[model samples]
Target: MIEIKNLSKAYKKRKVLHHIDATISNPGIYAVLGPNGSGKTTLMKICMGLVLPDEGDVYIYRESVRASIQYRRMVSYLPQIARFPDNLKVKELLQLTEHLRGKAQRKEMLMELLDLDPYMDQLFRNLSGGTQQKVNLVTCLMYDVPLYLLDEPTAALDPVTQIRLKEFIQHERERGKMVVLTTHVPHLVQAIADEIFFLLYGDIYFHGSVEQLIGAYQANDVEEAIARLLMYEQEKVKI
Candidate 1:
């Protein structure tokens, strides 16, 4: 479970997020949709305790994330971009991560699922962009955290890999894990999202079930519905 209350963040004097409140509980996939610079990544960072909120609180599993930083151990965060030590080999990286995680079975399972074996001997910097993304995904999934926060997880993934990743997400959700993802692609969101959050100007302008979004926008698909909502927000701003 994750609880965010009156959460806000800023750099210098410019505020990216305002007072916001949201709660996500149990095993379900939550999709967060927002325009560029709407603070979607910022929110995820705060939830993961990587960034402190300028105001308000974040509760993970009923405890303040700030008070129990170890709670982060139970979370797997896939940031917008992942950076790895240029010289480390895939196998070495996984080995180090597993050592740090105290040798968890989940790490091995994720490596197998991502087909990372082929690249085991290759240096991190030598891998292709898509392969690097695959490695990052595998790393995060390895923790077997009950909560996952993924940002633009499919950016460099191929179609088949993307489908496989989605299937894995679904499997985790079925196992009663919480997954929160931020993506520009609405089709993927439609396929896996049970709940959707539409963000504008650092605020959640709308949050509801997927069915409600479809009905409210009267759209044939999730992508169209999100487009309509974005346009509606733009029009409101203009007025």
Candidate 2:
């Protein structure tokens, strides 16, 4: 449902993404992996039209992202950072989000699953960091959209909540929804990601199934493979 071709982006003299190309035509979770300053976030932003590309274009459902915004209706995005008016209560924030989206939300079950009932009347800023991340997940995942873009979704979530989030991801995949996530959690990638895209130095270093990632790097595990990829980059600089 998403196609990126020859995408490139830069800030002044520094490039963040370089001629990246990929397509997602199936329903499953795709994990974008990269170290800091590797352009993972920039790639996601270009897809959402939050940042314009210096070259190439992103297409969603046969429409070019640079041309129109109507394609966003089919997308649900959860940013890396969740920010809101600190004075707003949890329920108020949710209500405002629904009103802005103009769509019926499936929030009740998610709220219960996340154990957010006690915080309904509490100010958003008063909640703990983990609680805020849970609320963030509820606000994004409770929507019925063709594509879900989550950046650092498991951040600040406890072990229990992380398990719950994985369950939700699996449910969506079975229901024919596409989830593209950016996470450094190795276990999360091995658990839910059907495809993994590793970004290195503004380019796609690797894009394949999780098994392929392991096999290509010849590592016994995901962590080892990731380390190898990082070291590979360092060696390139020394060359």
Candidate 3:
């Protein structure tokens, strides 16, 4: 459903993504794994048309992101950080989002699932970090979109909320929605990702299923596999 061709991006002298090419043709949960500054967020932003690629193009359902804004209608993005007007109440913010987008198909359900109903009348600035993240999730997931781009979705979430979010993501996949997320959590990827794209030094270092990643590194689990991959890359740099 999505194709990225020869995509490259640089910030002044620092290159974030280097001629990257990848495609997602099926409906499932895909995880983008990478260390900090490895361009995971940049890649997703490019796909969402929030950032322009210097060298190539991203096409959603056959329409180039560079060619049109309409392609974004199919995408719902949850940014790594959530920011809103401090004075607005939680419910008011949700209402504003609904006003901008169309009516959310599952807002109330998400709010309930995230335990956000109690804080509905509270001001945005008054919510705790975890609660704020829950609000962010409710806004993003409430829309019934074909594609979801979630960046560090479980940032401030507690274990219970994190598990709920995972369940929601899995449910989305079951409904034939394509869910793409970037996370440093190994267990989260192991639990929900049908496929993974591992980014290192601005390129796709590995792309495969969770079992394939562990098998490729000869590791017992996802955490060890990732550690091995990082150590191997560091040794290569030293060589």
Candidate 4:
């Protein structure tokens, strides 16, 4: 479980995250949904211990992330965008990452599961965007980490590849790994997310099961549900 308590961040005295407190107990896919600049990325970075928060603590499995290298070892993260060495081949990149992670050999299970065989010899810069995403994802999942944090992981994939990734997420969840991701694609969220965090204006406006959102909003789909919530919020501010 991941617990965030009174978390906040500011840049040059301009606040981004407020005193946000959230608990992620459900060990399945949890989608963090938000528009641009809603502080989703900042929250993820803080949870991953990449960014320091001005106030509050992040706890993973009852351990403070900031104080324990062991806690960091149990987490896998795939950023929204990544840049690799332009001169490295796919194999070399994977090799380097695995070595750094202390995994001398690739996890054959993960490689086969993600269908990573096809691009082993391709240059990092030459692969298509979607393929690059696959590589990025593979690099993270290769480690037997308990927590997975992915940001907009399906942004550039085709329908087939997207479907494949959805399956992969489910598989990971079933293995008792906590999968948290941020996404703007409602369809993808509806398909895989057991819980949704609807963030607005740097706050978590709603956090509930996907079915709860659909029922509470009286919407037939996730998109409509999201639209209803946003519209209601807008009207509340107008009054």
Candidate 5:
């Protein structure tokens, strides 16, 4: 469904992504894992056409991102930070998003699931961080699109809401939609990700299933596996 070919990006002297190549051909949750500055967000932004690649191209359903923007209509994106107008009410933000995008088929359902009705009349800036994140989620997930790009989706979410979001993501996968998310939470990745793309310093360090990741690192769990990978790199640097 998506193809990233020899994708590279740099900002002045520092490179954020390097000749990255990956393909998503099936419908499932794919986790893009990495430490800070590992180019996780950069990759997603490039895919969304929000940022242009320094080299190479991304294709969605065979259409190059550099070619046209019509392919974005097939994607639903949740940015890491919620930056809506401060004065707008929750309801207004939803209305505005729907106005910009087409009508959201699952807006009402997601609002109920996220318990957003109580906050509908509240100003976006007045809402709590978690509430704002919930609102962000509703705006993104309400669209019934073929692909979802979520960046740090559970950042400020409560445990209950996180569980609900995971369930919703699973449901989307069950319905044959591709969900790509970048998260630092190991357990969340273990629970929902069918495939993992582990990024380290602008390169894909590992790409496999959760089981394969742990097994490759000879670790019992995701957390330990990640630690081991970092330790391995550290040891390499000292060599």
Candidate 6:
């Protein structure tokens, strides 16, 4: 469903992604993992056409995203940080999104699933961080798209909400949709990810299944292996 070719991006003197080449053509959840500044968010933004790549091209459904953006119709993205107009109420914002998308989305269903109906009339800024995140999730997941790119979907979510998000992701995969996400939550990744891309220093350094990752790093679990990989990358940079 998606292909990235020779993708590279930099800001002034710093590079955020280097020749990132990957494909997400099949249905499954792929997790992108790394320490701070690994370019996970930048990678997703480039795919979404929100950020222009300094080099290379991203193709969605065989159409080049850099040249045309019609392919974005197949994607649903949940950004790491959501910024909404403070004056608008939660329900109003959702209505606006549905109007703009011109689709009969499952907004009401998502609101109920997230338990956001209670805050429907509250202004965006009035919601607490976790509540606001839930609102964002409702809007983002309301539509059924072929590809989903979620950056830290579990962030600011309560434990129960986190589990709900995981179940939702799994549901999408079962429906034959592609799900790509970046997260620091190890247990979440362990539960849902069919594949893992360990990004380090702006590049994908490791790609494998969860069990393969633990075996490769000789760590007792997913979190420990992730820690080991990050440390290995940092040390490699210094040498």
Q: Model 4: how large is the Cα RMSD against the reference?
A: 1.9
C-alpha lDDT (0 to 100) for residue 51 of candidate 5: 93
Clashes of 4: 0
Model 3, 1-239: lDDT tens per residue? 99989999999989999999999999999999989989999998898888988999999989999889897888999989887887999989999999999899999899889999999899999999999999999889999999999999999999999999999999999999999999989999999999999998789999999999999999998999999999998999999
Off by over 4 Å in 6: 237-239
Instruction: Score residue 30 of candidate 4 by CA lDDT.
Output: 93
Each prediction's TM-score versus the true structure:
0.95, 0.97, 0.98, 0.92, 0.98, 0.97
Give the clashing pairs for model 5: none
Worst 10 residues of 1 by lDDT: 101-110
Weakest ten-residue segment in model 4 by summed lDDT: 104-113
Number of the predicted model whose lDDT against the real structure is largest: 5
Q: Could you tell me the lDDT of residue 35 within candidate 2? A: 94
**Residue pairs with clashing backbones, model 6:** 1-25
lDDT of 1 by residue, 137-160 (tens): 987887767889999888898898
Select the stronger candidate by TM-score from 2 and 3.
Answer: 3
Error of 6 at 29 (Å): 0.4
In candidate 4, list every pair of residues with a backbone clash: none
Q: Which is the better candidate, 5 or 6, if ranked by lDDT?
A: 5
* Steric clashes per prediction: 0, 0, 0, 0, 0, 1
Indicate the residue-level lDDT of 150 in model 1: 95
Error of 2 at 173 (Å): 0.5
Q: Candidate 6 on 40-118: residue-level lDDT in tens?
A: 9998899888999999998989999889878878888999999888799998998898888867478777887789989
TM-score, structure 1 vs. true: 0.95
